[model samples]
Target: MKHLLFLYLGVVSSFASDTRPLKERVNEFCQKHRSIAEIEKRHAEWIKQEPDNPDAYILPANALAKAAETVNIVAGDQKDAIAVLTDPKTGKQVGSIAEGPDPAIIKRAEDILKAATKKFPQRLDIHVGRMAMSQRIKDTEAVTTAALDLLATAAKDPQTLRWIDNEQIDGVPLKKALEEVEARIRWLYSFEKDETDKFAQDCALKALELAPGNVELLNFAAIRHLYRGEWKEGREYLLRAEIAAPRDWIVQHNIARASAELGDKADALKRLQAVIKAVPGTDDAKAAEASIKSLGLDVPK
Candidate 1:
């Protein structure tokens, strides 16, 4: 009876120790069949087997997100027209409303990630994974919220943050991690929506609060002001950036541009000339020369 008990324990342990890559295991269900129902079934089985493994949650979330995107396309849901086509003579308009991702499917993906993060709050990878899904769906607010949450968590105890493999992210400096979040928020700004712009500002300000004198954040602030025609404010931010990274040619050039916009021609000209002189024969100098030409200021030659 003792030998039989040992044999049974060995068999159970062997099944529990899955040596295959986590992604490989999750992706197997997503392959060949690519059906959400089938994937969910397999996911349920995997979850039951490894309820404590974060991969069991995170990888399945990825698969579900992909499946949602696929279903949107396969169902012809993306073909709906955002604008109506009018028949002028008939005075009739016909069109389908713009269709986005299926909310229910996306919700499932988010819920799975939410459960994973709640269970493993220290897993930076899970947090970032959820943020990435939000980004894919163009949910700027959700992404912003997630980014802020990450910043707050990291600020509390950065040393405790861990990645997918359960190893501390100690190798990644806190500044670099903040910059990573900043980069994602910056990507949101490219959408050019007022909402995204506000979210970007919020994220940038929070990041700057944690990492003062960050030239990139300062530059982003300056550019945001420039976009709004706030020349003086833009120049102020750029000036701060210049103090932090005096050698950055882009900042020097932008400072000149902002001065020109603010009607400070002499100062702008002086700054432009300085940039051209400092980086002569480089692409940046070429850009400065072009700016001088556009401003009708004489090139230093």
Candidate 2:
């Protein structure tokens, strides 16, 4: 999934105008399943040859990161890891062995992209690539710093920022990319890590500074405060999100939640009813009905 996000963002695959040959060679190597070390070497040479092309750095970095993933079978109950395999025939839990990306290789990959950022600080794609790779390794500390740097860069003059394919990356396009990062962070937050949760909220708030009216960011911001029992703050963002996406069912659900939290039973009941009306048979509607019952409000006929 992280790899897919990197591809979607054009981070793992983009070529400078004069570096198409390098890109093709890299693609060919990958298709042939050539050694990742060879691919890394080729990309490293390309990086040296074309020091200013951020894509040169990104390609090798991605290869290294992908090559780092490994799976091994060992003994012991390690339920605290990703990709825990089970013994299907026995229908019992087997010993959990840690199998995932190699930390040392991931660090090397991260370092390459980090250097790219230093050389091309204005390249938004490079920064995004780094962030995606860090998330792949579950390096939330790195992610937090990189995310803040990305937001700071985004808050600068648009003319200074560069994206791959020479596409303009301000306003909606930028917002969409940031939202992708936010989605990944949200996934990390689901583990209930205090640092990851704080980083998620910080990311939403920073992104809102760049596009305060973004419905997704607004919703995220509202959820951050709402989860912390800050009803008023959450409601402030939810109301703005509602204005931006008036028909958004999730937004309506959140508004209902905030209203209920604020002790506005009547308002909450009305919004909950609206949610059910807008999205009948969906999870939101079911949840809305449950909320209605919780609030001791009758279903509207």
Positional deviation of 208 in candidate 2, in angstroms?
Answer: 0.5
**Residues 173-232, model 2: lDDT tens digits:** 566557656776676567676666777878888888888888887887777677778889
Worst 10 residues of 2 by lDDT: 4-13
Worst 10 residues of 1 by lDDT: 1-10
lDDT of model number 1? 0.69
What overall lDDT, based on C-alpha atoms, would model 2 receive against the true structure? 0.71
**TM value for model 1:** 0.75
* Winning model by TM-score: 2
Could you list the CA RMSD of all candidates, in the order they appear?
9.6, 4.7
Residues 72-180, model 1: lDDT tens digits: 2232223644545555789665433454555566667767776776666666766677676676667778888888887877777676666645645557647656866
Each prediction's number of clashing residue pairs? 0, 0
Off by over 4 Å in 1: 1-19, 28-52, 71-103, 296-301
lDDT for 47 (candidate 2): 77
| Model 1 RMSD in angstroms | 9.6
